[model samples]
Target: MIVGIIGGGQLAQMLAMAGQPLGIRCLFLDPAPDACARTAGELLCGDYGDARLLDELARRATVVTYEFENVPEASLRRLASRVRVHPHPGALALARDRWHEKRLFADLGLSTPPFVAVDTRADLDRALAVTGWPAVLKTRTMGYDGKGQRVLRTPGDVDAAFAALSGTPLILEGFVAFDREVSLVAVRSADGDARFYPLTENVHRNGVLVQSRARPGDPMASRAEGYVGRLLAHLDYVGVLAVEFFQKGDMLLANEMAPRVHNSGHWTLEGAETSQFENHMRAVLGLPLGATHGLAPSGMVNFVGYLPEASAVLAVPGTHLHVYGKAARPGRKLGHATVRAPREGDVLDALARLRMLADAGGAG
Candidate 1:
């Protein structure tokens, strides 16, 4: 089976890696000629709006999915009419806008931070009045990796925050003072068969994921599964869905969700009985879902800006490295390393070793 993927980046690259073992070939449609996923399979370089390219992609592939939600709604709607797209276009559209996404979460009885729309200066004031200071102002569209957002810590920060991100539809989210952040990576099929990976504890720096530790059988795992399951069934969703949460005492507040494979689940690449990438393929292909159990206690460290020496990273016991074939950029995610061990302590030891190497500027 040939699967068509929109956006040719690391996620697509990993998808292709997982699909190849199942005799599934991937073709990517991305505007960037040098997209790293090009090495995974055939690449068709064109803008998302190009009708000719979209027609050709739909014509060639049996199924289609996008690596990211930022793909234009019009493009997805056009393709949905021509080919099968997992998770549905309507789900994609809702996930693309923060306001709609939050409302959906609230409607489903999932806890989310208080939020209000901000379009004009007065709207900002009104939102602040409701959400109060120290809230987060985020653009409704095209924001990722911590970009397109401002943290308003005081009344004095409002005008500056608005000036910095002027003219974009925004959402002001009340600050969440949670103990920690965790996420659930779940997959559902057309048959309504579903399973979830172990909940993962994530640590972020400047809005970018720096590390994630898989907490299999954590007390909060069941709670997260319940919330994510509600979303999957509600969307009649197919393929992998990732939902992030902020935990305070016994409460878990929905942070947001990703419609495709997520950064937090990368540990499953080597730690789970079946990697998230493989299960995503299985779900979309209508095959029976794989086991979601972790092979061991696991931790994953993301390589940002640049990667450490591969040899050094591999030297750590139980560590496996995956480097995305891309040039270095200040905030770009270049690769990640996963460590699995018989015990959480061993996993932490391996993680510390890997972090040391990554922090030493890749020096041996």
Candidate 2:
């Protein structure tokens, strides 16, 4: 079967790589002519809203899926009339808006940080009064990797935050003094079978994911798995969905949900018995979900800003590198490296070594 993936970025590139060996052909559509996935599959370069191009894509592929949630809803609706789109557009709608997402989570009996809509200055002030100060103001749509978000520590910061957003509909979320941040990458088949990978402890640098390590001993691990199962059933969701959480004391507060494969699950490519991309493909294709087994205690470190020194990092034992093959730019995620060891502690040590090498300007 041929699958046309929207948004030719690293996620689509990796999905193409995974589908190739499984006898599935992958095609990509993106505005950028030089997108990384363009090198791996048939590339259709054009605006997402170009109906002519979308129709051509639908005719050529057996099914359609997206690598990112920012895909135009109208485009998806138009394509759905022709070809199958997995995880469904309804799921995308919920994932695309923070307010709707919080409501969905709350409806599922899941706990989320207090949040209120900010459509006007009055709404912002009201949200602040209700949720309190030290809140986060985020755009209602197309916000990711720490962009389109600002922290309001005091009342003085509110105007600047709103000014930065420039009147876009927003969500003011109360800040939870969290103990740690973690995410669960789960997949559900079309028939409703669900599976979850090990929870990952994530650390962010300037809003972008910098490192993720498997947290096998987390007390909330079971709760996270249960939450994912409930969410998948609630959305009737099929394909990989990642749920991020803020751990405060004994509570795990829902932070956000991604309808597609996530960066936090990058370790699964080498650390798990089944990679998330493969599982996502299987789920969408009505194939049985693969095992979510951890091969070894693993750590995934993102290579952002510039391409990391791959040759130097490869010289280190048990290090596996995957480069996205994108052009260099400040704060751009160019690639990632996964280090594995017999024990989880050893994986952490390897991450420390990798960080030192990075500090010394050593190449992969």
Candidate 3:
């Protein structure tokens, strides 16, 4: 079986690696001639909007899937007309726009931070009225890794933010002063079979994920699962879905969702009975779903902007490193390492060491 992947980045590369043992070959269509996923599969280099390239991918793949949420909706529709795109095009479209995504979450009975759409300066004022002070202003589309957003606390801040981010549809969400951030990574099949990894507690810097710890028996796990499961069944979703949330006391407020393999679930590669990449392949292929339980106390640290010496990282007991084959640049996701240990304390100690190395490497 051959799977066609859109956007040949690290996620696609990992997916290809996971599928290899299943005798599933992956072919990637990526605009970047140097896309790292090329090392894992055949790469057809071209813009995602190129019709000829889309046709070729459709002609070759058993089924198609994406690695990111920002894949152009028109391109997705074009592919759907010619081939199967799992997790569905509608899911992609909804996940692309913050307003529509929040609406769907609210409609599905998921609590969300108060939000209002911002299109004009007057609309910004109106939205701020609803959301109050210290809210976040984000472009409704194309925002990721903490880009395309501003924290508005005062009139001057709001004015400067609007001046900088205007001309794009925006969303104003009430700032969440929550205890912590966590995400649920779940996968569902076309047959309705589903498996979920333990909830992940995350730490972020500059809107980029820095670390994640798998919480197998988190007190909030069941609530988080209920919310994400509603999304899976509602979208009739197939493949992996990650929903990030802000936790306050016992409440979990929806932040956003990613429709494909996500940064938070990277720990599953070394920590779970079956890696998220493998299970995503199985779900998209309509094969049996794999177990999502942790192999032990697990955690992960991301290598952003730079990566430390591999020997230093591996020296941390229970640490496994994965480096993306790409040049390091400020704010770029270069790689990650997963840590698994017999006890939570060991996992935490290893992660603390790994993060220090990651921070030092990225510092330069």
Candidate 4:
């Protein structure tokens, strides 16, 4: 079967690479001339709203999916009329707006941070009055990797926070003094059979994810599963979705959701019995979902900024490096590396060793 993937980034590239072995042809759509997926598939360079490109893609692919949540709703709606789009556009719409996301979670009785909508200055003021200071002001739409968000540490910071977003739809969220942030990567089949990977403990630097350790042993894993179950049932969602959470005391607070494969789950490529990309494809294709078993205690570290020296990283025992062949730029996610070891060995220790190798300019 042919699978057409929207957004030609490393995720699409990895999806294409994984699909190839399964006798599935992959195609990618993106405007970036040098997008990483271009090297792995037949890339149609065009805007997501370009009807001409969508028409061509529909004619070629048996099914369509997206690599990122930021895909234009119009594009998905247009394509859905011609071909199948997995996980449904409703999920996409929900994921795009933070206020809607929080509401959905609440409606389903899922735990989420205290949040209020902010569309106007008055809304911000009201939200602050209720949620209080030291909150996070985030754009309701088009936010990722810490972009389009500002922290309101004091009352004085509120105006500047609002000014920074320039009156875009917003969500005023109370800060969770959480112990750690975690993500649940789960897949729901067309038949509604859901399988979940071990939860990942994430560490972010400046809002961008830096590393993820698998099976962090948070009691929240079961709670995360419950949240995913309700979310999938609500959307009748088919294919993979990742939900992020903040652990505050014994409670797990919903942070956000990703409708596509997530960066935090990259360790599954080498660490799990079923890689997320493959499971996502299977779920979307109406095939049985694969096991989410972890092969080992693993940690995935993102390679950001300049490309790291690959040789040094490869030299580390149990290290697996994946580099998205992209031009080097400061703060850009060039690729990632996963280090696997026995469950008895310290996962954090492996992560620290990988970090040392990465800091020394080891190849990624």
lDDT of 4 by residue, 298-341 (tens): 88988877566788778767888899998877778888899888
Worst 10 residues of 4 by lDDT: 355-364
If scored against the real structure, what TM-score would every candidate get? 0.98, 0.97, 0.99, 0.97
lDDT of every predicted structure (CA atoms): 0.90, 0.89, 0.94, 0.88
Candidate 2 clashing pairs, residues 3+ apart or interchain: 309-363, 309-364, 310-364, 311-364, 312-364, 313-364
Q: Write the per-residue lDDT of candidate 1 for residues 1-364, one digit (tens) a residue.
A: 9999999999999999999989999999999999999988989999988889998888998889989999988888888899998878888888899999999999999998899988999998889889876799999988888899999998889889999987889999999878999999999999998899999999888899888999988999988898999999999999999999999999999989999999999999999999999998888878899999999899999888878988889889899999998998877888999999898999999988877766565421
Q: What's each prediction's clash count?
A: 0, 6, 0, 4
- Per-residue CA lDDT of model 2 for 185-293, tens digit only, reads 9999988989999999998878889889876656789999988889999999989999999999989999999999999999999989899999998888888899997
- lDDT by residue for model 3 (1-364), tens: 9999999999999999999999999999898999999999999999999999999999999999999888887889899999999989999899999999999999999999999999999999999999998899999999998999999988889889999899989999999999999999999999998778999999999899999999999999999999999999999999999999999988899999999999999999999999999999999999999999999999999999988999999999999999999998988999999999999999999999998999896452
Better of 1 and 2 by lDDT: 1
- The regions of model 4 sitting more than 4 angstroms off are 344-346, 360-364
The full ranking of all candidates by lDDT, starting with the best, is: 3, 1, 2, 4
- Choose 3 or 4, whichever is better by TM-score: 3
Off by over 4 Å in 2: 358-364
lDDT of 3 at 188: 98
